[model samples]
Target: MRYFLKRFGFMALTVFAVCALTFFLMNAIPGGTAELILKHTFVGLEESATEEQLNQISSRYNLDDPLYIQFFRWVKAAVTGEGIGTSYVFRKPVLYLLALRLPATIQLAGASMAIAVLAGVSLGIYSALRENRISDHILRVATLFGVSMPCFWVALLLILVFSLKLKLVPVAGYGSLENLFLPAAALSLHSMAAVMRVTRTSMLETLGQEYIRFAKAKGLPLRKIISRHALKNAMLPVVTVIGFQMGNLLGGTIVIEKIFAWPGIGSLLVDSISARDLPVVQGCVLAIVSMFLLVNFLVDMLYTHLDPRIRYG
Candidate 1:
């Protein structure tokens, strides 16, 4: 209970810090917020926004308030569910825009995470069991390739191969499961490689332990020894890598989402930034931070389950 309370308090502080930094840094951007909002909001119009219009926007959003005042106001609003404010570009509530996009982002993150864990762990086990054989060498090379390549480059490569040459999936855009493949693959490759390396290393070490040798000498079935003994112990480090990667995938999907034209928070954030949509930008940052923090917290709690020795105070 004490550990939980401490972590929960720390999480709250982190969220507040992230929001405060985002708010102040956003304000520090060059030019007037209202002017930028007006410029983008009425783009392609022959006439620019007049002084009166800019003033009205400023007043309506409390843009003229002192910096700290605006920050506190936003915090209050956020707690009340409308805290992120309205989008200057879309002219809608920021929360509403996020709500529309969150499901897609969650789906992408979840799919990518699933693929990384399943493929990485399976291949990792196979490679470890094989040791110095050709299959293990090949998997090692593949992991190197996965880890070395940039996600955007991987995304383009996947598109070129799967979407263009083979027509296995669409070039971009989202809807069907097929649409998810390229982006998820691109986003997950590095994480998969990382998990593979960690799992392989951990599994190798666990397999060499005295208990493993004893179990084998006692005529324990290979599958039972590996699954019930080796795998469980090896999984501690693997779980740590997985937890970190999951949080990273959630935030890193921004690039993948934009590349694939997925209507997720990543693409929304990119558009919002390009348009200088302050409210949307702030809201997106908040959402991403909250998610990342929440994932880390859950992973910490999960430690107790994975290892009996891991006890919280």
Candidate 2:
């Protein structure tokens, strides 16, 4: 309980710092949503609109306030559950935009991580078991390629080979299992490579331990010895990597999401930035930071379960 509480306190502090930084950075930008809106709205009517009309519009949006005051008002609305107001570009509520896009992003991130964990662990185990063999050599080379490949290039290659050439999967858009495979594969490749290396190294170290040798000396079957003794210990490091990679997967889905035209938070973020929509950008950044922190907390809790040495205070 003490450990959990301490971590929770730290998380709260981290979140407040992130929020403050985000607010200040957004304000520090050259212009704001109000300025953009005013430019577009008063394009031809600059002479017709009286000073009162301009002041009314600016006051209505609270654009006339100081930067600190504006930030505090936004913070108040966010905490009070009063919605983050409409986007200056889209003219829709920020909360509404998030509600529509967040699920897709979550789904993409979850599927990518799941695939990376399963495939990477399996291959890593196989390579470790067959160390110095042809299979290990092949896997090592493949993992190197994966690690070296840029995600955007991988995404484009997959699009060309799978979507364009083979016509095996849909080229773009979200929804349906068929549409998910390429993007998920692209997202998982680099993570899978890291997992493979971690698993192989851990397994090699675990297999050389005295306990493993003793298990083998008991005339236990190779499968039983490896599964019951070696694999479990080897998995500790792999679990740690997976936990860290899950956070990366969430943040790094931007390229894959954009390539596939998936309606995820990454795509929304890109669009918001292009349109200079401050509220939407702030909300998206906050959501991502919160999710990443939550994931790390869960991963820490999981460590205690996965390894007996990781006891909570």
Best by TM-score: 1
Error of 1 at 22 (Å): 1.3
Per-model TM-score on C-alpha atoms: 0.95, 0.90
- Write out the backbone clash pairs for model 2: none
Stretches of model 2 off by over 4 angstroms after superposition:
38-57
lDDT of candidate model 1 versus the reference: 0.88
Leading candidate by lDDT: 1
lDDT of 1 by residue, 24-128 (tens): 887888888888777787756436678898899899888899999988887898888765798888889998999999999999998888999999998999999
Segments of candidate 1 deviating more than 4 angstroms: 45-47
